[model samples]
Target: MECLTSFCETHLQPHQIAPALKRHKLINPVKNLEDRMCKKHKKPLELFCRTEQMCVCQVCTVTDHKGHHTVPLKKEFGEKKAELGRTKNQMQQMIQKCLQKVKEIKHSAELSNRDAEREREESEQVFTTLVRSMQRSQAEVSKMIGEKQKATMRQAESLIKELEQEITELQRRCSELDQLSHTKDHLHLLQSSPSLCPPTSTKDWPDVSITQNESKWNVQKDISQLDKKVRRALSELEEKLNNVLEKSKGDDLKRMQQYAVDVTMDPDTAHPLIIVSGNGKLVRTGHLEQNHFYNLKRFRSRVAVLAKEGFSSGRFYYEVQVKGKTGWNVGVAKESINRKIGGLYPEQGFWTVWLSFQVDYEACTDPHTPLSLKSKPEKLGVFVDYEEGQVSFYDVDTRSHIFSFTGCTFTEKLYPYLNPFDDYDGSNSAPMIITPVNQTP
Candidate 1:
């Protein structure tokens, strides 16, 4: 009241404020007629009935709205205004949360689109490069075959030309002899006989044959090998790509590496003629007899040795260095393999890759399946999942898989087998050494 009096004193004169306050208090006659009188009671609406939700006179509030919750109009107005303000604030916060979620969803969608496009481009490039490699291989094979045929045909043509010249000279001699027989010139004929000494310059055609079919057969064989190699290369590439993608999640090589064990050659199982190095990691053919007494587990004729450690279950990996050595066999074999049979075959409990003369790598099987390799592996990594019944071979140098034997039921223990077969030349005299495996990155 004091603040209002001070505001009125400052803004207006005391007598002039009375006229202004009377005008502000005056209600519109049309609005007051409806609001001031109740329709049914014909009395001024004095109270608000909260239960019946309507304006009512004091008598109606006691009769119809009696025994129900009720509140004054001014009190309900204040509560509803406060609730409206809270509702406005809650709605604003909800809108802000929705906007933040929208930003996160849009960001994820952009990243997905970019990742999909990049993978699509990479797939296109992989297939394109594969096609180009196949074309290049075809061209190289064709050129090699053409050169071989041209060389053989040129030699044949040269021989044919020389034979034709010899025939021409013999015909000239025959014509001269016929003329001398028709004439009475015995002296001239006798004198010409010295010049016709049985055509001594003629060459002996000793069945010269152009073995064209043999060359064609060899080309066919080489092309077949090339086809297998290309197929293997593509498979390897796809496997590597899959591994790279899976490495984002986990790596199998790392898990296998965890099971790595140090392996050495066991001289007890080695053949008497096989010499093991002092370190027990190298083995080669030896001229001096081992002098050790023969045993049931020892190999007799096959220059082979077994690893000191044998695996019965679980996975294991080891590497061997075969660099600069030919005519060698290395892989896993059953502990009960025949010692005297000297046969290297799967049915005989021997599973190995054989490197021999004119052959790169051949897996010992019933028919000895030849492996098509891009190059000879200098270091070979062997992995065995004994529980899973799988044995895989890899080129440690190139970090590529070479071969695998799957679905093998190992009833007994398996040992690493190595055979440094009689060396081919001085070139193959290098010992087959077991090298430590370098863990992959």
Candidate 2:
């Protein structure tokens, strides 16, 4: 068989002409016409196998595709073209979703840049203040040293003048006595001897050396006083830095609150001993395990519960009140974590900060790092940036940062976690309450 390209009416189709018209062949304006022929049967495929959703020849329909619903290939082509239109619509929707995600990423980057700039400015302010303080202290100590040196020089000059005058008087007395002895004048000699014998008219020349040691002692005393001033200045500087840090924390708290979300306890994932409040705002441990229906989501051991809400992307912040609770754990846990024996480690799908023994605190990590906080936080703030892989904890009462888990890789949805830590002793009996954040003014 041969093919030719021409207008449909002008070209003589080979199938229509006899073998004598070997110069002419059918011209198909549509591309890939050969693909319409069945390879095995060497025949034009005219039917479609609805079961296989593929074009087939009539021979294929009665043989390989027996009992399968078949339709005209031309009809199937129309349906497939319409189906492609629907697929194109679906692609548009997927494209729009990706565009939305791109916008979100860009917005987050912008926010991160803004925060970095603020941090830089604040750091410059603190270092500038520290440098100025040191310079002022240095100037004051230098002035004291210079003034002391001048005073010492003046005292030495005054003592030297007095001693020089006494030497002149003694020399004059000796010359007069020599003159009197030569002139044989007993009265003059006696008068000069009495004056000379009186050890000159100098005022008590005993230990008349200007004591450099005394001046040194005065400088030392000034230095000691300067030390006290430096200590006081340093203490003031510490207070000032603390004030700055506290104000920054307050500002950050307000910012974090902008992402604040309302959270409630979920009883399904809670331990058997845990009790979720009616309002779902609080959770506590009961002395005895409650009789409940069997649930795979429930925590059978640890006295912990997950919030009803879960986040897979972006940022979220929430606060919890642990005022009366002596021991508690608060943070986020990845979905699909072990419910039977929940472990508070990132490896175990938990990123958390916990308090134990009333005062000790730790950020749950692979090794669980210890944290020493200055003030006991009656209220705690938890913030998570899923894309950035950061989970931070704050002391709401003191407006201070307690700990942060950084460099994490989260691939699943995260749920807010809370545990009241059911201690055998009645000390940790307080319920962990989800509270509204009080943003500092």
Candidate 3:
């Protein structure tokens, strides 16, 4: 029985419990079991777990770890679990933050795309508008060019027709001359052979001869008159045509439109005392003893003044003089005219001319109140200060600086005035001379 019992125990146990144990001994199952055992061995004391103090297991204390400092299994497990929990919570927060950041980036990108799209559309619109405007301008320019071309073509055609007509008329006149020459030759032959009274009709031979001679004379006179008229017409036409051709060559056409004022100053009167002149004669004089006055008759018909025809529409230049005197106010008056005096003054765009003197001198009053000769005088010069007024003083050649003055005003409605007290003296009657700037040769 003992043997039987042993046999049964061995065989049945092996078949049943052994199989169950083997199944549990599989790698995954054994690993799970070992992990459980490890955890069991690592379990901490209840007090250590509750207090979170240091505690360890047999597995931790064996071998090299024997007698080594260790923390309680429960405490270590609690700490690890709590740390793992914190890590999980942190990971969850990080994911939430990442999602939020992604959302912000996506929103910004969408907005930027929208703005870029709008800008692109606006740029396209502007480009289109510019293109259309350019096209319109191009069309206008093209139309203008076409019109000019047509006008040129018409002018050329008209000229050709006129030339053809002239040639035809000349040919016709040549043919008439040839016929007259042949008829004259036949008449001369007949007159030389008067003995051959060929087919004389006694009825009216004399009458016919007289009538034919008279008609030939009349024809010859008519031809002479026509030739004279034609020659004259041709000459006039040729002159006009040549002029047109010359004008078409270049900008020289503008030269024909200019008018000139040939001023010839008297060698003696060409002094600085004369402020203004017309036809080379002194229109305004500055004398040492006389007040400022103007000669209206001296004003030229073409003189440019504000009241009259403003400065001629074309380029013009003229020169005048200004004499300096002591204490006597004198200058060119621009813009204004003196109706009473029949001239333009500062109000009419006239400017005054003033000169400076190195030495002290006496001032001259108006012609009505002349200066006394007893007043001593010295060197005189002119000054111009743009800040005070637009008037500027330049040398007779206008290439050098004379002087400048500030705080001076000139009558606008009257012609420019000159005071001899400023500089003009019998010895130095002429002090200032003016010429139009940029005069043509």
Highest TM-score against the true fold, candidate: 2
Which candidate has the highest lDDT of all? 2
Q: After superposition, how far is residue 81 of candidate 2 from its true place, in Å?
A: 4.9
In model 3, which runs have C-alpha deviations exceeding 4 angstroms?
A: 1-31, 38-72, 185-441
Candidate 2 lDDT score relative to the true structure: 0.82
lDDT of 3 by residue, 225-341 (tens): 655655565566556554444333221212211222333343222223345444443433445322334454233231222112123222222334444322333444333333234
In candidate 3 the C-alpha lDDT for residue 251 amounts to 17
Lowest summed-lDDT stretch of 10 residues in model 1? Answer: 1-10
Ranking by lDDT: 2, 1, 3
- lDDT digits (tens) for residues 1-441 of candidate 1: 211122334554453567645443222234235546667766556567777777777667677778766676667778879989899989999999999867865865675576557656766666777788789888989998998889789978988898899889889988887787787777887887775666676445675667788788888888898989888878976876665554422234444454567999999999987899888998888766679887898888788899989989977888889888767888999998888875787777887877875466877777877788877788887889888888877777666667788888888999999988875356667788888766766
Q: What's the true lDDT of residue 229 in model 3? A: 58
- Local error of candidate 3 at residue 5 (angstroms): 24
Show how many residue pairs clash in every candidate, following the order shown. Answer: 0, 0, 69
Clashing pairs in 2: none
